[model samples]
Target chain A: MSNGIRVAALEDIPEGEGIVIDKSVTGTADDIALLRDTDGSVWALDDTCTHEDASLAEGWVEDGYVECPLHASRFCLKSGEVQNLPATRSTCPHRVEVRDGEVYLFPNETP
Target chain B: MDADISRVVVVGGGIAGVSTVAALRAGGFDGDLTLVDTGEFPYDRPPLSKEYLAGRRDLKQIALRTPQWYDQQDVRLVNLTAVTALRPAEGAVELAGGRLLPADRVVLATGGGAARPPIPGSDGERVHVLREAEDADRLRTVLVPGARLLVVGAGLIGAEVASTAVDLGCEVVLADPVNPPLAAAVGIDLAAWLHGQHAARGIAVVPAGVESFEPTAAGIAARFSSGHEPRVFDAAVLGVGMVPQTALAVAAGLETERGIVVDTCQVTSNPAVLAVGDSARTRRDGLLLPRTEHWEAAQQDAARAAATLLGRPAPPATAPWFWTDRHGRHVEAVGRMAEADQVVIRGSFDDPAFSVFGLRAGLVVAAAAVDDPTAVRAARRMIDRRVRIDPARLEDPSVNLRALLR
Candidate 1:
């Protein structure tokens, strides 16, 4: 009955790290990557890298971008714009908000 | 001679060639640029042995650039055309059917073909080599479940094919002279683990070189150099190495040893011509460096070649990096492991993620990881930035890699 699924507490995600919201829970076609940048800002994007089947949730988050773990393709966490290749297509950005101390995920919605 | 160049022709459509064109356009080179390729479209080759062979990705999905990219970049797409000759004296490129195209400069990005060793009876119809998309397609048809397969050379390509074949339910026999290959590139420990994984996953690992092949009524029989009895296989694949495609350069009277010799700027012996990718080998200070046949190496060559042609400072060199994926495990290595005097591993080999760091004189020289690309990425930065690090901290799994950068 809720559009925003309360996934975790704000403290659940480490700074400059990402956690995956499985596809079944998010009700999306793919898993979602909830990234916490070094600046303490939270962002969400489809976890599956557009270039391949690699999970972006496992990528290295730094400087407002997430570098794919399999390949070094960096994606802008804010806009999901690909900053490099072997990945040319941008991942899908998602909307996220913090309510009280909980993080809410809006599936298939842009921030 | 202030770079009044206008028309340019690039031969080959591999990663090196595409990257060259992309880099040229990115660097504001508005000259008349043309890409002459032998394929219908430029596609990435790494997937040929993995995804494409597994029938997971098709030709279009593996394309390096889209159809709209050529038009957007204003690059003339001369598909299915091969440059027959490089007439540097007249600044012209001759194509098949005797058409001469005027060019101010020529970039030779022709990639290499798979090495076909002189093994007796190797030319049989059952013998195969994977290089082009067509080759992958042909290999795929025989990869049916339970088909007996003999893959020679336990290197990257051979191991990858063996892993893929096993996944497809094919009976895979992997043979190589070396007990565990890739030691110099990824260090000894990781190499052993990677090589040993084949046997644990339903693959027959043989420590012997192939002697010859004999076609029998039942598939093909292969004799081993170890004096083992002849084994029958439905098919066999050669994954030894690559032979540089330097015929055009040789016939054109350019300097070629193992590959086309180029200077710091990727300019070939002929000033009017340049070579990049596997077909190009760099000669610096009268020293010829070995040809790097990896995907990233080719891409890196593109950036350097563009800068050289545009008269801009070449991008600062970084630690060389490469990657391979097999058995659902992703492996990455940076720099040269052979340069290390000490090797320290982060986390256990059985862990989901582990990295081996190669250190020399308290400096991180190289690193290889199993499903831990972050560690390799951090290692690459440490190597490039020349950051001094303590091996103890690097080995501690609890220490975040970012702290090591300091």
Candidate 2:
């Protein structure tokens, strides 16, 4: 059931930004935040910030982490571990593969 | 100095103290670590005035760390106990039961108590103060529907409680001497806009301080400093300020002015005893800087204290930032906006989300945002890195903040 679904082209996510894929597409509990780090690596985390009601998709991606746009709480893109205060819980990170400039998401599967 | 370290005792279980232990472990400090706290568990305080006060969250929900954390970290958790003395000479801390825990380093995170201004009848049963979870529990009981609540001081805590109380169906009247509160922190223009939000959301905002309080059969009568007619309310909340719990430090002979005087490394006057959080104040060049009383400040202090304990280089310093949720608005401010020569509004006030950037010497010095945390976060980097940017580009919402950093 955890098939790698093509979500978006790699270029769709700009460096240092994120895009939210609706939970409907991923069949996950929450929408997924597709992040493109400044270093050009792609990562996926649950869209909602663990500390509050906020979209991680709207966060700033830099230095391999996504900062929650609500309170500046940051999460490691690779591990989804919180790197900031006011947020102690980590978001769920999913496996993603980039092939031929296209992003394939393995929903509910950790990378 | 680092070679001799073995045992470390952290007093208090608030964010500051808890994070101290957290940072110490994160920094690879495997020595004997003991945390003495009066509470059963370390919990976050910001929620005390908002979510906890509204009965939306519980004690466990606000706990800073899981119960297994202390055990996993191999740090001794002495819960429901107070540290009565800091015996630097004996190299230990005296707990309430008279047990002295050995310590090579002692960290004081005693936090503070909500200040109850010197107003007659201010200590009445109806008067409330939000600091500890117990205080929130007491205040929440009276926040029933149609309860007349008088929230004094329109600062962060006061404003937050007023917002929470109002949301709980209490008729809130927020009184403060300042016309628009938090002007120094968020700037006058933004302060006015923020304070105006109270009225827009059905809270009564008064530009006056409390002269006195008189408890009567009907309720408590509060006379405003503005000399207006005295008003009666079912309950009163004193949010004027906080009184640092410095008695312990003072009794221990730690140099304390307004707060425990600590150096840049979070070391107190006594090298063996260090302090952090609200109860600790930083002194540099024989000058004591203001005590940072926010949650993030406490955490930052803990990290710094941990670094000192581990004898490691300090983490990269960043611009200070804090957030407050009031009246359903998530507001955040970073840096010293009062020092800014100019304030630039990034978006229209009428917009759903906007930010005000304070600029000085062609650089962003501070920023406050309404429903716009990204702007504040970006502004924080600009302030910390001292990035020069065009005001026009900053003012334009279309300009990506990341580009401004370049």
Candidate 3:
């Protein structure tokens, strides 16, 4: 059995923006960001930046990369690869699938 | 392309050192990495002056990386081992423990040490200079509520400590030789405004140089050059400044000015050695930025230096950036304002959020935003591209700085 959970609705998150979904899967304060790219593609990643303890939900998303609001470190929303300095570690990329206009997240393995 | 670049030695286990090691691993550099430090562990330094002093944060939370993370990253941690000298000719460092670690490449991230004033009795138990984690831990126990805290120097650290003391309900007195804080970095007008802001917060801003401090039964008494006005205080904090640890670089025959002189790639005079963080004095377009002590600058410099070591072209230097938090208010600034000819103010001064733009030769060279992250973000981009916006538009609070970049 897969340990996946329904996080948010597609309508709740607009296109070309990110919405932070708070969940209790992780003992720590875990926040997941649902981002919609310019090409209408959606991606999910951990809201806490791996470099510093900054919130990625406050970051600016553009061209499939979410720039950390604190230091402007860019991270690829899909692969979670940190594209810039200051933040060299990649954020935990969550597996997301749209089922009946609702987004379900698999919180176990981070890509 | 890998031409035998294996061993990488990082000196100094502060934020810059740990970040360098992490960045190298993340950048796909599978080298024999060794991190040497005099300190027991890698910890955050910024909090030493603020949260740590206020007894709000514990030592465990400030550790940059857990011991397990170092092992997982394949990093060799040499703790409590001080590097006495650097032999750049042989690409090796001499540790005080009588060990020589040879490396294909070396990174000097030794950071900076606190600068103590020449005044007598400056090193007493009642007086303290904050730099390391232990320093803050020891100082926090003494900075009790209702204590008379006399803080010398009005720089970023000085001001932050003063603000923290005030928040803790301590009687804080701020003294500096200069009339206004940051007058040397920022202009007099801005510094004066900052002084006024601090004064409004009920802190006594004493504009006098310290002659000496005498220990009394109640506390320490600070004597200033302007007629000795003795004030008993439970504790005193010295946040004067920092001196770059460039002794190793100088001993290794590296070019030294105010700090270890480095190029855009953060490469010291010796091509095999690089300096990053506060210890590096990088030159850009003939201007020497001796002390870009901000955390962001250290991270960027470390990344650039790493790229240079890997034989990659480094990115162009962006505008200088720095931020400070005082009395729950966040102040962020970008670029060098010392060279600006025109100053533009946006938003009402009475409002909590406002900004000042510094323009030189019609270009937005620098900006300082108070409680205004939006304006700061815009100013960062404008400074990065060296873009010139209309002075009137810059002064208008409604004008989005981001649109100006567009």
Candidate 4:
């Protein structure tokens, strides 16, 4: 189920920043976390950390990796690969595009 | 004297030893690497007290890395073997099977063993010490529903085991010499709140010393120093911390006081020998830093030791940090909490989500948070960047913490 929907305005999230789109806005079953790296490249991933119930949106983003604030585990936002530990699994990555100054997120169907 | 540094041998198979080997390989070291560990596999120890002990996780799940990973890394893992002696002068380590392995450098991350105080019925079959996987497995058998468990000591281990036991539907009595343990680390007020959280979860907090344990008709009787009636328990877990394994270091004629003394580079007095983890104390210029047993400390030690061997500058020193999971709440504390001159409470303690940040001058020194990783994350950066913070703003949750960074 591709819930491809507009999540937030492009300017809403500054460069090298991230924003969390809760289920309320996305109309999806999961929270989508969108991050914009320093290069102005945007990526989308599951908001919940694979290790625990903490929100990946609450984590610190740096160099394309988002570090879970709970246990310091990090995940690559682009590929969803686990870059650090306490977290053995990777969060599901989603397809994203910025068009007409708006960010659109296509949630991972299998996530 | 570099002494033709080519081959390196690391003793002990815990995180420190394994991480050192991994770091060495990651740093593009193409030399012979050997690792000697007493355990069958180098598993993660933190899970032993929580998920693994609760039977929610298995040994394979806790293994730091797969066997194939070691092979890929070209690390010779000598499992189920002990380093009988260390001959630092000769750059060799004698194994339990009377084999001497030559090396240019040797790292002793022997770890430590659970401290078993002299208790009357400690020899009993039901008395358990949660250190190794075997200890957790034995304790798992008796942690059945409605079973009575006496956990001696209220430190991290005891409190964690007690939390796990409660989750297993066991009647847990956490006894300690002092009420609300870890006051020195988390402050007295917060410690009491944590103790109360355990009590609220139906864990009996016995703020008294366990005088002795005697075998009774039904189970083991734990007599307390508080003059209370002896309480019988189906099993007792000793969580009185660990004793550093330093016999081999002493036997090797290395200078040791409590643990193997090493410098900031993790190099022992004998240049060819190094020590890390729970069995190592950092010493420099006749002064010593207290040895730490936390998991992250071991990892940092391994990184520094590896950098030393690689002839590279040491990584930037970050504040020490540790976390604990108890009563379904994740509590994280970073840096030295005791060094704070002022304390700021962010969020109300009555609320489930709250944090306390300790500050020295205007900079954040340390922070302890319950279910609030955002605050702790900000606090860690503030401490690392040495960013000055306004105490009033810290207490006000409306003020963005990251903004204070700039």
Per-model CA lDDT versus the true structure: 0.91, 0.90, 0.80, 0.86
Off by over 4 Å in 1: A1-11, A23-28, A38-40, A95-111
- Which parts of model 3 are misplaced by more than 4 Å? A1-58, A67-111, B184-189, B283-289
Ordered from best to worst TM-score, the candidate numbers read 2, 1, 4, 3
lDDT of 3 by residue, B340-395 (tens): 89989898667868888889989888888777755767777788887878999999
Please, what are the lDDT tens digits per residue for candidate 4 over residues B1-406?
1338789999998889888998888877888999998889898898888989999989988888778878999999999999999887777999998999998899999999999888777878878998899999999999999999999998999999999999999999999978778876777777888888988999988888888888888899989987877899999999998999999989888889989999999998789899989999988777888888898889889989999998988888888888889889888778788898899999988896888999988789999888887788778889999988889999998887766765
lDDT of 3 by residue, A24-60 (tens): 6432257887776656666888888875566777666
lDDT, candidate 4, residue B116?
88
Q: Note the DockQ of each predicted structure.
A: 0.55, 0.69, 0.18, 0.47
Q: Compose the digit string of candidate 1's lDDT tens values, residues B1-406.
A: 1276788888999999999999999988999999999999999998998999999999999898889989999999899998999998999999998999998889999999999999999999999999999999999999999999999999999999998999899999999989789999999889999998999898988899999999999899999997867799999999999999999999999999999999988999998899999999999999999999989888888888888878899898888899998988999999999999999999998876899999999999999999899899899989999999989999999998976764
Q: What does the lDDT read for residue A107 in candidate 2? A: 84
Name the candidate, 2 or 4, with the larger lDDT value: 2
Where model 2 places Cα greater than 4 Å from the true spot, the runs are A1-3
In model 4, the runs with Cα more than 4 Å from the true position are A1-5, A11-32, A36-41, A46-54, A88-95, A106-111, B1-3
Clash numbers, per candidate? 0, 0, 0, 0
TM-score of 1: 0.94
Task: Give the winner by lDDT: 1 or 3.
Answer: 1
Q: Which candidate number has the best TM-score?
A: 2
Models 1 onward score TM values of 0.94, 0.98, 0.85, 0.92
Using DockQ as the measure, name the better of candidate 3 and candidate 4. 4
TM-score of 3: 0.85
